[model samples]
Target: MAALSAAEQTVDTEHFSESMHSLSSDAEAFPADSAEQHDFVVDFIEKEVGSDLKSLKNVSNLLKKLTDENNVLEEQVLTVSSSVPPKVSAALSAAEEARCSLEELLKKERLISNMLHQHLQGAQPWMDNLGQILNQVDHIERHMEYLRCLQHIEELSAAVQQCLMTSSVWEAIRAVDSMAALDTGLSQSACSHLQDFLRETLHFWHKIIKDRLTIDFEKVLTQLHWPIISPPTQSLTPTASSPEISSQLELLVTQLLALQTSDDLLSQKDLASGKGGPSAQTVSLATPTSLAPPLCLPIQIMLLPLSKRFRYHFFGNRQTNTPNKPEWYLTQALMWMGNSTTFMEEKIQPILDRAGADISARVELCRGLLSLVQEKVASDASRLLYDDALFSHLVEEVLQFEKELRSNHSYPAALPGLLHLLLEDAVLQKWLTVERKMAVEKMDAMLSAEGAWSSQYKDISDMDELKAPDCAETFMTLLQVITERYRALPCPSAQLKFLGLQRELVDDFRIRLTQVMKEESRCPLGARYCAILNAVNYISTILSDWGDNVFFLQLQQAAVSLGDDVVLRDLGVLELGRLASLEGSLFEGLLALLDRLKGDMLGRLLEWTMREVIEKARPYGQDRWLSLPSQHDLSTMTLSSSACPMMLCVRDRLLHLHQSLSLSLFQLAWQGLADRLNKFLYQDVRRENPQKHCLCFYDLSPTSLNV
Candidate 1:
């Protein structure tokens, strides 16, 4: 309006200026309450315009008269009237002054706007940030509302309690749920109030449902003396209508989950869990046989603590920070599973695993576990139900069960329920897959041509390192590391499966040994024996750890049998050679190896040696192989007694063996071997297949077999 008034002033004065006749319209458009000033301006304008108008009329009459008279007279009249109206000239001059002032104001305003634009450029970023801050602040009121509501938790708790007391369950549920909608930690005072509220809620609900369930539970303990698992509520399926679940147990769990409690209150629930009643009567169980063990408690008593644990872990106040959006019912449905697992492993499994545990007890325990599991994890037909806890429990049960069975040196009963439980859980499937992978890994580690350098893999040389973690390892050697690893492994049934895999590896190792022995070279035979000894000892040593696992016992027996077969099959050559290389001696029983060699490789080698002796003697022109002259020299035949050092070594070894053995075992074993060889030499080498010469053993053997 100022700019417009200023522009109007400038235009009125500098451009086609308006006459005073429009002043009345201008006054009305620009009204003011200054009556004195208005009257003054009106008087001044009337006085100024009055004379001008009188002069103009006189001039106009004079011009008309003059025009009628003469043109010169008209010009003179107009000049005289213009001079007579000086006040009107003063008013025109004031309007010109106002226009000039407005022009100055416009120039100053332009200058100020230009300066502000420069500063505004620098301030744009701050302005933009301020805008964003204002937008974010829009939620401040809502956050304050939530905080205010949080402060009122005590009041809300009171309201809920009142609602519950009045039997307005829906109102109580709404009140509690509204409290749940908030996600904030409470002050200690408020938290205590909340815990009080939660306790009241629990007390109220328990007041309604306790008597009914207590009676049922007490009757169950008194009569059946076992867990009376409620039939599972059908999980949410499209075709199936919801099962009517008014059972006191379900109601107790359901209502308890709807409130808020402190961590301490959550830990304190026993009466609601059915433990306040009298303890179940214990029956005297018949003592188990030597093979089977007995459990520590009867089934009802065993499940009692578990029942309490489940009630404690599950059926709690909906936590303050817990998510409130998910389908809470399905969560409540699956809630017992995790509690059941903790209860079974911590409370029940130990009893079943105790010494002298009876099968009947295990059966009852399994039944309880299965029933509890089915009731919680399997009962839900809801699509949203997740039973990961179920798989973890079943895995622990099967693994621990097998471990107990193996430890007691007893077998397990067929549990079709366990199989079905495992079969339904995809987690169990994945667990089995991981177990299989570990088994394969162990076997590959065993069979790999390369040795394990790190402690992670088995190294035959690092027996102590291998034995380090093998606390319960029964194996006397490096194999105990594997047993320990498998035992510590998390996969269900992995220890037994891994032991079976070791057995397969052992079979493969034996086959490899057989293939190696088929080679004709003797030099490679020594290295082969070393490899065999190392491999067999590596396994056999670990298999000695029967304290933890019974399966290692089987491997130990197999390893011993393999050792015996390899030693006797080689006729103590490999064994004696190995012991000799290591600067060790054979035991007294190794002399028996000589007997095992008869009619085998050692017999053929012996027959070939006698023929070589006969031929060497002929070349010596000593048709004298019958007996070495006590003074005979081997120089002529390039051998003493015409026998190779290997033969003489064998001969000397036999002599030593005979000297060491008493007459009985030595004759029963190697004496027969020597007699058969001598018979072959005398009958076949001397008469039939060799030159007729007296082949003599007097230099190396006893008189009876010297031939």
Candidate 2:
């Protein structure tokens, strides 16, 4: 068996070697051979190594097992080599895909992180701003609540104080300080309600104050006992006051006396220091103390509460236990006249005197006197003849005083009072009529030569340029006085007489104006003449209404005739175009007259005057007039043995007329003159020259032409 085994081993070895060769030579071609060879190797090993032979059999079993294990390993290797490579490739691909996905996911996460960072970056500022805005809203609401609480408390305190002061519930306000103290604790809602309540309360209080004032004023009026003159006396009446109250009053009086003394000292010091001089630092500082009294007694009287006892004593029914009495105001006036005469005479009269006894002073004095008169008239006592007599005497005395002061120009202050007094009294009106006549005569004489009107005219003539002075303002003042005086008289005859006088005055004025116009026409240039004409026209226009009276109409006609002569002179200059160079003065006169005349009258009069001027100027041809040389040639050229001055006078009269009636009239009259000239040329053998137009006279003989 060993030998056989050896031989088999050699054969097995050879087969194994041959199989190894074939496997090495062609690994792919041996699929059947490889399996068979693997099985054969296993079978040979199992056969050669029988189980009986212990060590050898164990070696053969181990070799055979090792060969079987090798074959299984080979199969596993082949399967692993083929499947594992594909599986490994798929795993590698999947792993690569997963890595790529992870990379993409990381990139997406990075992108999302960047967007979140950007969003957070944008949101941070807004969040911070919102936080700041919310903080401010919390602050404003706190202050509003504080103001509302203060107003409510003020109203409550006022109501409580008002109830405490007077039993009648309508007393003067006493404790405003207490009311103001309550303003701190009030809420907003309470304050609004309190404000409304307080407004209504204030209105109520204001009405009460007014009623009280009226009652006091009425009581003052009732206490005056008119028509009864009495001397001043200081009588001490018993007072119902405790000793302490009396002591307090005494102390108050002492303090008031001290204050008065101090005030007097200060006033004296101020007067001595010349603080009220014209050169003082301020206007108030310059005001004289005498002009404005230190004590305002009238206003103080108005402020005092109504005296109930005085009202009961005076205004009560006469049939009852109450005594009949006069008005308090009259009584007060009497008392003031007696006791405060020094105040009125020393302080008030000095102011009135310094006011220059002018119309304004008179007006103020009249007002004060009238107030006293009203109080006297309102008194319940019987009317006193002495009072009426005293008023009349005062009126007469003031009038006489004014008259005496008139020459000194010191009565202007008194004139207003005089006028008012004249209006107030019928007797004064009658007195004024006689006085006015005397005044009128005196005024007429003064105004005749040295008065404002004549002086003004004389002054105007003395000026470099002769102009009619503006007498309108002075005339207006005269008219105002005359009108007022005429109105004061109740008689229609007197008014008619005044109207007649006014008409006469206006006629005289018109005559003077006409004379002025005529005199002005003698001026070489029409400028001064035209200006005077305009003044005349202005005066004529103002007095035109006077012409409505038949008597005045005749005067106006004469004046108009004189004006016509002036107008004629102005027209002559205008025709020569001399007035055009006169600085528009001639045209100004005509325009003034045209404006003054009513439209219809102006049109008609202007047309008539223009026609007259045109007709008169027709005989003097333009060429003949143009050929006449200026004043320089007057001595050398005696164009005609004619009175040149007379001709000049006529020419000047016509020129004046033309200028006084404005150039507008001439322009209207010359409207168709150009066309008429063209027609005349066409009929009269007029030919147009190349350089200049020429006219050929066909019907002219040498003798007829005087050539």
TM-score leader: 1
Candidate 1 wrong stretches, greater than 4 Å: 1-398, 401-437, 448-524, 530-623, 626-641, 644-647, 651-680, 683-693, 696-707
* Candidate 2 stretches greater than 4 Å from native: 1-432, 435-443, 450-476, 483-536, 541-707
207: Cα error in model 2, Å? 34
lDDT of 2 by residue, 1-707 (tens): 99997876666656655755765555446775766766675577467654443335245456578799999999999987887777888899999999999999999999999999999999999989988887766556545544443444344445644554553222233322233223222323444666455434433443443344444433432343211234534332333543444344333222222223223333343456675353222222322233423432222232232223333433455332221222233344333334433333433344334433322322233234323333223231122223443343443444343343343323233223232323333444444455455445544543344323322443333341223334533543555456554553333333444444554454454455455445544442344444434344444444444335443343334333343333224455454243233232222333444344323333443344434434543332223333344545455434232323334543555555454433433343233332333343343223322211221222222233121
Error of 2 at 453 (Å): 8.3
lDDT of 1 by residue, 231-323 (tens): 324432322221222133234323333332321132234323443343211111111123222222234444665566544543344342122
TM-score for each predicted model, relative to the true structure: 0.28, 0.24
